[model samples]
Target: MGRLDKLPPYLFSAIDQAKAAALAKGVDVVDLGIGDPDRPTPASLVEVMAAAVADPAFHRYPAQRGTPRLRQAIAAWLKRRHHTVVDPNTQVLVLIGSKEGLGHLPTTCVEEGDNVLVPDLGYPVYGQATLLAGGEPRVFSLAAERGFLPDFAELEKLADEKTRMIFLNYPNNPTGAVADEEFWKRMIAFTTKHNIRLVNDAAYLEVVPGGEAALSLLQVASPSKDRVIELHSLSKMFNMTGWRIAFAVGHPELVGDLGRVKESMDSGVFNAVQETATYALGEAFEGLLAEVMDVYPKRRQVINAALAKMGVEVFPSPATFYVWAKVPTEESSIEFCGRALEEIGTVITPGLGFGTGGDGWFRISLTASDESIAEGARRLEGWK
Candidate 1:
């Protein structure tokens, strides 16, 4: 009777139910289910926001695309970080958060019958948006055999006349896989050749640890006939998830279309939030990012070590704050998560929640405190 009825059940809620059941039984739950960072926003940024909120100018409606100061800051950060140049006036549109933009972008480019290429184990919003926009979602498999990267050959084979968009994420979610410059070049060439609009969800772009940084999809070339857009969020980088601030940047026409959607759907991100985000996107904020990143390496090591001691295998993720591990037993992903809650009092995201390609895998967020992560791993070791 309704389009919302077609959507699959939310995975996080199901996991939460199991976690609640464990808590009801008086179990001490070490939750690693969601990717929300546990750290507080840096003191300096908090101070800036507190001061900005007192200004009457910030109380007014913000520019639909974003404040000019925020857009300029984003542009400067992109150029400094990725060697990519973009016009603040035409190529940038701020989002309430990347999720808000990601959910609405499909409606701008996709139609009732178009086919959108999506990663099999990608963020669920990609596929859900496609369906909500009355478009078809064709899953592109990401397998361990290929280091969890997409197979261009397979994607080409799967693409057809109806295909209109391709969604990619690097420093990917749930899997922690990353793409290199050469990979970006190939993806650009492939999308250009096929004339499909390419959208890169770069939410975790700045989260890479002890590895080469992820490249912006815009690094390749300017838009000639084909289009490319990227969505970047401050949530993971600045521990500003609750602030709901981000931006989409790329081809001018595509960015404008996305802006039009924003204009029609809502007023815009609050001016006060944009003022603080301007400070967060500045070059000086890298010091805060460095401090936040320092916490992840040790946390990752403790979790990986615990998994190894339990006779389970998992490669420490070079990027992102998640640890993706193959399930040691043959249990289904949901069943494995349920059993972890029942046995070890630990809560993790079942891989199948990402997509069927993740059937025998599970994801753990490094968003918990180091002590909590170590204890959760220790409990799993006892279960093993």
Candidate 2:
């Protein structure tokens, strides 16, 4: 509690507290405000974790840099998924979760007062990570007109000598916007020119439509090979959120630096959990990924169709399971979310919770059961 008021009420926490209050009052809130995957982890992976627990070695401290097998698995998975070969010993490092890896990178890379380019309407963690790392988070707005992509011309001008890192998320969370190959090349050039590092969050990589995806900073084919690192999560795609299995892959030096910070932080995640992730990686979902991805669009349609009936025009969200909707009339997002939950028993995240650029919009998650999604939609019909 020592001068730690540097943060805002991150979107999910406020909604979570409200959900708890409603549940306490015997109201059945469907709890769609958070982006957590509601799907269960595949049973096959659980069996491997259970087996690993029986090994005495797993009972000992796991390696700080993860086990060789786990690292190999991560490299293998990256090669399989992205068609990019990452050296397991150098270009890969296992994280407690991608969040922790991301949270610590600023500390490892940025010195005090160094600027980090952050997205205005992207994941809250991108900014928080910069702040916690004692770096300046120079937010570049993701205007709706630009399809939520940052104006690099403006951002490029902002990146003077002090900027050290730039965060990019494709299949972006909350906004669900994807960038093209040109976007990757533009950023790679900018980072290369400025001698800054770029961190790409590929958390939603496997959830893209028809399995057609965007380019990653790590996949930019730079000869220096020290320009970018991509963070991947096993959360949404594999339903492994609680397992905390994630990794960073790219420049050997960059991954090595993050690995040193990680080594100082903790030994590693549960060896059993790492083993489980290894097994899960083998089951790539292949074309099945697109099939799984189809569910999100259907849920989006359901909630959006209902919102349309209530006269709320939703914006296109191509990747993550989110729908950005302008609150009906001129009601503020916080006020609208409050009234919706109290009167309609439906909950959502306010736009202001994301950042200043998100003030006029609210995000509805499509990651829950379709029935629950439809019910959430039906609740919106009562808004008018």
Candidate 3:
């Protein structure tokens, strides 16, 4: 309870509690509050995992960083997907999940009282991790005017000698904004000039449409990998959230440092899980990604059409399955979400949960079934 006092309330957990209460009252809830994918893990990946689990070799503790085979698979995947080459032995380190890796990274790079530049309305883990590392977090607002992208001019103002790191997430959580090559180049240049480490959380990179893949920071940061590290997750891409495995790729030094810190905290990801993930990232991944790309866009369409009929305009994202919408009234996001939950029995995420910069908006996840999403929309339409 001591250090816990320093943490902000977990907004999602609170929403879950409210939803449970509604259920207690016998309300049928269309829960779009969480970002978990509704799809099952592809049969191929599960089959590989099932076979791996029976192997006596996989029963042992995994390497603290990752198995050489797993690291090679990740490196190969990066080469094929983003066209970025990396040294598997030196640059790749596995984690329990992207969330764990992102949160623990600051501990290795930031010293007490150093400045950590974080995006407002971005993932909460960035700021929380900064605080846990005893660093001061300076937030840069992501405005809809700029397509929910971070304002470079504003970020410049927040930079100084004390700045140690910059945290970014593309196809961002809650906002559903994707980054392009130009943006990545600019960010790499900015961090390089400041001599600051850049950390990009790329969990949604593969959760994009068929033709357009999200650009990797690694691709732009290249020879400058010493200054940047990117984290990717199997959770969104493979529908493996519960599996809890991800990897960090970057400068050998940064990856090594993170591995050291993780070693002190936990032994490693389960070997069996790592073996399965290695297969997921290898030859079998592309077709599964294509199937995912096909499914989510239609779901996005269903949700978007419903919101439009309710007069709730939103930006159509090229990646990620979230819709960020402005509140119809002047009510606070919490108040708006409260009304939706109590009157309509639909659990939505209030934008304020992301940050104060997101105050006038709310988030709707496209993770529900087509029928469930449509029903949620119908309820909203019926709201007087």
Candidate 4:
């Protein structure tokens, strides 16, 4: 058998293993674990997709850049919802999903041995992608004291001339933390001084708890415009995770680079899905999507309240479908996760999978309903 010399830690795999073991035993698992939306896609998007499939043309090879109709709709939606302007031809590029878009971005830019600034507890792929690109991954700390956002002091300590890109995600995952507009300005200034390109992932932009706005790197001041590339996914917003559809908007120069890599990578997205996404955007989101975004926050409150009642310490996540709750006592993060799964059949993501900063913390998502949330809470009453 062949084997690799080294591979980075498989953080979520351990959690998945423990969760899987319990599931195999027929435990009644209340799955507030994965961040995936448990809701259905909008009816209008579904209707359009069904209609488009009848054309049969969408079954052929799609343009690697996606159809112009989808491209234009993405651009218009960006302009309308984000108040950010982008050119459809050069500045907008489609992806299998934002995950691939982000994973491959470093390969398009970073040379071997170059450094990439990453949050210690940011999305695991940020570092994973950097590794696959043959780049060094330098993690910046995001302690709770720092509100789970990047701390410049730690970032400065890890900086060097080899650094080429900095991966940023606001309304963060695993922490439910967010950065303000001022934070964006400061980040822009810092990156400018360091000559670092910014890769901002705005996947959770439309999924916030109270609709409080998310900060965009494009909106930052003092950097050469387009020094940043912003990414968006239809997964959370339109309930299209399995659809594998998303786009990147920002600096035409950088966006073009991703397009080039993409052409050599795959043929394109499913034409019907792109067509349906375009239809949804053209109608301005109407009431269909509005109803979908409404479901998570109510679920968020349920998990938040349940955690509180169980003496689990947590705060309301500003955005996204996750709740980062603290498990009391002196249990290690991985152990806490194991016990939770074995005892309650409740599988939560262990924060340690996120990185060093997540040590001793556990994350519970509100993917379940109010009754499920209440039941999970009742089960936790046995936890100690």
Alpha-carbon TM-score of each model against the true structure: 0.97, 0.93, 0.96, 0.94
TM-score of 4: 0.94
Error at 339, model 3, angstroms: 0.4
lDDT of 1 by residue, 1-384 (tens): 356877878887878877787889899999988799999988988899899999998888788899999999988988888788889999999999999999998989887879899999989999999999988899999998887889999999978878888999987898888777788788888887888889999999889765345767777657434489999999998899999999999999889999998888988998889988988778666687887778888888888888888777785467999999989998998999888888778898889999999889999899998888988878877786
Q: Kindly report the root-mean-square deviation of model 1 from the true structure over all alpha carbons.
A: 1.5
Q: What is the lDDT of residue 22 in candidate 3?
A: 99
The regions of model 1 sitting more than 4 angstroms off are 210-212, 223-226
Q: CA shift at 259, candidate 2, in angstroms?
A: 0.5
- Clashing residue pairs in all predictions, respectively, total 0, 0, 0, 0
Model 4 clash pairs are none
Assess each prediction's global lDDT (C-alpha) against the native: 0.86, 0.79, 0.86, 0.79
lDDT of candidate 2 at residue 222, scale 0 to 100: 53
- Whose TM-score is higher: candidate 2's or candidate 4's? 4
**Candidate 1 global lDDT:** 0.86
lDDT of 2 by residue, 1-384 (tens): 221466656666777788789889988786668787777776666677889989887888877787888889887876676678878998888888888988888887888779899888777888888887777889899888998888978887889899989888887777777877788888787888999988888888776655665555556655237578889887877777888988888888888899888887888988888887777676645543544566787787788788888888777766777888887768888888887888878888888887888888888988788888988887788666
